[model samples]
Target: MRKWFIERAPDRDVLLKSRWLAPVASRLAPATIWQFNRRSIARGLALGLFVGFILPIGQIILAVLFAASIRANILIASAATLITNPLTFPPIYYAAYRTGTFLLDLVGGARAAQTIAAAQPTGIWTSLSATSLSTFVGLLVFATLSSILAFAAVHLAWRVSLIWRWRRRGGTDRAVTRPTIHQEPPSV
Candidate 1:
């Protein structure tokens, strides 16, 4: 029964693995990320870090999907790490930590600060200070966001390019064969 289900249902690994994904992914049509030009895709991946940092949630999942769809190398997809490098890690995390703390405090009332510190004792004591928490959270958030965005952007560019190529080819064919309805009929 378990084997049957494994074969019938979309397993998590199967869904996650790009090669295995081809069959189901085919439904994505001409917009597939797999169809993208390699150099362009690589460049796009490199540039996506900027967008990733600004995006909300850990949207790097989208980046992975995009990379898979575009068939761009996973290395390029993971390159959003450029934004979270050693130099920037401290500042970004510090900002996120402060933002999260401030936001939490605003919602949790005047006692929010003391309560959070107390509740997540180890995290607070070891790493959640305004000075440290930002770095920690920044690292976490940057990793999460970049991965998601790179995948998404790569996939999006691939899909658009595929559709555009198809349309362009299709248009040229149509134009070449199109007949003029306004033309006079041939005489016998």
Candidate 2:
């Protein structure tokens, strides 16, 4: 096995020297961004699109984190979030509400039952119209929970895929191997 750490030029030495701050600097500092692997970028884009369509917030963050961990360009990952931009907010929110309602029924059936009964007189049409407090709260709760779930799914997906890829590439000699932290190079 061979590992090499390229020494940064003197003008950019401070950024390259601070072990703790180097990673952050790499992310936030401006530089001539480069693409690592086209295949990985394509896979990431597809994943980001699916996530944005189904799970916006969590998907956005997960995509960013995933790219960051792999030392991919953060700008591209950040752009992927546009998949769920303002244009699609309403529909996404609506779907999130329905999903949340389903989850609420499963986990807190009794509470949901009570809320439904108490808010029944508001009428089904009126309830989902965003006028009633219960409806609003339900929607909010559903979006939050769904977002959480989506994030969990993203995390699991990244871990599983990364592990599988590593093993397939013949990197599984150890039963357990900690993931590496990918950092960008300091700009000259």
Q: Which candidate is the best by lDDT?
A: 1
lDDT of candidate 2 at residue 139, scale 0 to 100: 50
**TM-score result, candidate 1:** 0.44
Q: Candidate 2, overall lDDT? A: 0.52
Backbone clashes in model 2, listed as residue pairs = none
Question: On a 0 to 100 scale, what is the lDDT of residue 47 in model 1?
Answer: 39
Task: Give a tens-digit lDDT track for model 2, residues 97-181.
Answer: 6655565557775365666567767667645443333334455564455445544655566677778888777655553454346
- What TM-score would each prediction reach against the true structure? 0.44, 0.36
lDDT of 1 by residue, 18-80 (tens): 775565555333333432354545544643463345444454555555555545533344455
Error of 2 at 28 (Å): 5.9
The Cα RMSD in angstroms, rounded to one decimal, for candidate 2 relative to the true structure is 15.8
> What number of clashing residue pairs does each candidate have, in the order they appear?
25, 0
lDDT of candidate model 1 versus the reference: 0.53
